[model samples]
Target: MIPKVPSSPQAISKALHSQRSKTFNAFYASIRSLRQTPVEPVDPPSPADNDFILSILRANPSLRDTRSYLASFGVQPQRPKTKSEAQLPEIVIPPPPLPKTSPSLGKVSTEEQHAPSPVIHSILNPVYKRTALVKIQGPFTDVQLDSITRGLAYLEKLGMVSVIVVESDDVPKGDLEERQLLIDEVMRVVTSLERQGSHARPIVGAVVRLGPKPGAEESNTDPTFITPETHIFPSDLTQIRSSLRAGEIPVVAPFALDSFCRSVRVDANDAIAGLACGMVEAGSDNPSEDIDLTPLRLMIINKRGGVPSYARSGYPHLLINLDQEYHHILDTFDPRWKESHPHSFSDLALARTCLQYMPPSSSAIMVSHKSPSSLIGNLITNKPAVSSSLPHALLQGNLRLTPHTPTLLRRGLPIQVIRSLADIDQVKMTTLLEQSFNRKLDQEAFYGRLERTLDFVIIAGDYAGTAIVTNEGNPGSPDPISYLDKFAVLPSHQGDGTVDFLWVALHDESYGLGHPFSANPNGGKGGKGEGRDLVWRSRANNPVNKWYFERSTGHLRMGDWVLFWSDAEKRLKIEETRRGGAGLSFIENWESGRLGNWAQVIPKIPSSWK
Candidate 1:
């Protein structure tokens, strides 16, 4: 049964603070029961249902006589056509990624939703064949050529990677020199395969330049949009499947940088990522086991390991043959900040050329000390994308993030302060959480929750790697307490001082620090919290409990919630009062945890929103 509401704020306050033993449990039991209140069968008159619409028309009788009103205006109704001329409105929310369990042609799955590290499902499963898709930076010098040849030999020896994709877009710039260079490289690779002693030679083909798709660039108002350049745009991937089907390696062709001669450079990272995505769209196919076995691999090799040693955020791709004019333009921006944040330079036209594009995926950008083939062997033989012993830092760390125990943090990445969920890029945020939590978030439900309950949200690193401090306390209470909600860090970035950064930032926010970041840049900041003391809860089985317990001044175990507090006095008071059978308000806060209807959208997504 639903509990009766107290008539006034004073009555509610008195009941909340009541000393009677049964009052705490009775109130809590009622609150718990309140959550279970039988919802009316909404089908009859839902906001958009026919009954509701009819009721609205009934309330305003004039609105129901639209036909007569139209007749007075000399208008007449007509039968609907097979298809309405009206285009369906543009979708605000991007579609969810393809399912990893059963990926189809051209469909790539989000890494966060799949296994912590996708070491190739083909390894254990007999259903899919292992294949290699190499996207290397072109016009290589003698040294790079030797290294690539040796790398291919090494990969072939392991038989873990087979198909190689050479794109024409990476060809060197010139009237015909760039095009010739690509053709020559293809011949070189084909020759190399034939000369090698009777090993299974990979099927090679050159994919032509796949430029912007039909009517795609229209919605792109950002004069600065670089998605098509960095990431494989989904619309044009069918060409890749066709090339693959014809036993040809798809190569990138030269794209126009201007009306005449200038050509865009090749982005090896995006090339590899793009071709692999094409294979996904083509769907998995059975390979001939009678010959060589190879898992699909996308290889990018360069002097600098695709990523810098330190972490930074931007589209993933390497710039090739930078000209003196372009170099002069790049000189304007700080080299350091430019690497960390590419969005800083989208305004400069020449600098714009430097941007490389790759879509968001579980593609981990790492600095490989070993050769390409050597890394392939390590990948096939070992698991854990970033092994504990190896000290190599992952560049573009957010892409490879999965919800496993994080490795210790090495370099301190910057934390971004977000006051409301609206300020966030919801699509990107949703993608990151889906991967982190390994569950799908209902798009509308996620937005609705944020609209009503979101108060404070903080993100660390390129993607959201932290929590939302919400559900602080009920109205009328002097100190309602705040919650640390939906806290998360990529396993690779954990232990690398991320949590410590978060702890200090939140503490400072409540302790008279500047709002740090502007709230909900989408709108205005929310009402400030009056109370300085904060409280949060964690599940009992969470591994992060040790980290929470050590940092927290005190804690309490109530039901399934193990509440922790930064305030020493408050923590002890709750602990002692509860033991003595004296009433406390902390229990109420626990009841309120994850209580909103919107909360279900992201529910217990991850443990310890610390």
Candidate 2:
């Protein structure tokens, strides 16, 4: 039988503090229980059942109805027909023409002079093949010839199996007035192919004219000089018929050329250059992979422990302290203030300013010490009224100005509130970070050991706080840290760096560092004091504590290097330790004693050093 436990505040606090200890004992007990009895595997679905479901859906006619009775059985209704399908009419075909009378056999033939031409019948037949004729009339520049060649090459590659080119002189050239007549002939061919549906493939046949060969001089001695001219036009109907019969996609030289001309008149060289630029833009011809810039959730806490406020008293001078600073923390983090001080500005300002350049898709969440009730009340009260004058301030200066009607904010998805650090335990914080990072902790014994070592917790979400629990094995222990680590929080409370630490910790065991358990694999023999290593080692010895330490360390290392925002000194110390160097050393005489060996690798201290 389970023992009864009190749910009083004192009992709860004790439980929260001893979360890690309780979690370890519970997990150990669970593993022991699991070893005694193994679980059975689930059975797979039968093939006959799958086939029956598919057949039932396909054969059911009532499934087509929007409010179909089949829906009662969880079957989806078929989609309704679209407007295009309903509007289209069925196609109709005309009867074939009657045969002509035998004029030669009868003395006075019954054949009519106005009888429909055979060519017209052939053109109307859907199965008949038709060809597009093209002609090019030019003074014959090399560029024009090259363009035509390229067009022809493209057509050949597309498998227009029957393509032919002829010289302008090969056919009778028409006068300028009959140019329309030539275009009409070409349109007729295209129309014929359209009527043929998929049976016919359109062909582009061309005839080109060279006005005169280069380097051939004109006769200067003639008394009356005649200027040579180039004219490209379709030949008469007779010539078109002859060309058609010859199986050449009909062409009438220069005029036919105009029909084949495509939009965008650029040479091959320009086309190649444009392609090269596009390839470069597409990043070396490997199809561009999209960059994911998912927004990060950040939990901000006032290190000073309380909310800062500012009020104007009767005094003439304005006072500044923690109160005033609390309201302005957002402004300090904003990128604008750096511009006001030009002389003191450095690369740091430039780096901060770069954050503003990120695309609109990127986002961040800021949490403060505001009470949940106050925050919710403020949100409801501030619902926008009919505002003509520059809508009510969207953000407290420097905070990203999200719209008041934002979907996330309106849904109460932004800020989370915690009254104090004790409200959240280390396990919850670790779990929050892990969920944010989309990581799963290593399930191996290493992770189990690390999990029991975590004592530090950060109360995140919109409003942030830090909780440090010392889980000593006790009867009034709080919920197991393992349970707390599985809780999911609002997206805004999840900071990328915070989540990154959890992810790193989860993976840190493989790296042989970061987590206390993983870092000191020899069972915690490194340092004995309450120094950083010792703090890490003590945490690592407990499974949960080690897990939390590894996760936090991992996050710290993987997170962005926002110098001012992060603990710069702590980061430096960690790096030096990892590199096997002493942390924050101030050796007076490096040439003597223990420092002598390191002195050989170290350069002389700067002369400016006191």
Give the winner by lDDT.
1
- The CA lDDT at 42 in model 2 is 17
Give one digit per residue, the lDDT tens place, for model 1 in 1-610. 2235456666555543442222322222222232222221111111112221222222221211222212221212333433543455644643322223322223334543433211122112121223455444344554555455545544443333344544433454454676566556666655554443213223223222344433546855646444333233344455544444443333443232322434444543334433444444333332222221122333443333432111122222221112111222244334664554332222222122212221121122222223433343232322223332211122224444332111111223445567766688887777666776666777676666566656677766677466667654444445444556666666554433455445544554442222222111111222133224455677788867876775564567756767665542333344556779765555455345423422332234343221
Q: For model 1, where is the 10-residue window of minimal lDDT?
A: 39-48
List lDDT for all candidates, in order: 0.39, 0.25
Listed per model in order, the count of residue pairs whose N, CA or C atoms clash below 3 Å is 40, 35
lDDT score, candidate 2, position 276 = 19
362 in model 2: Cα distance from truth in Å?
5.5
lDDT of 2 by residue, 543-596 (tens): 233324422322112122100011112334455677685554443231123222
Tell me the spans in candidate 1 whose CA falls farther than 4 Å from its real position: 1-122, 125-127, 130-133, 138-172, 175-180, 187-206, 209-211, 218-299, 306-333, 336-455, 458-466, 470-540, 543-610
Off by over 4 Å in 2: 1-82, 85-457, 462-610
lDDT of 2 at 219: 32
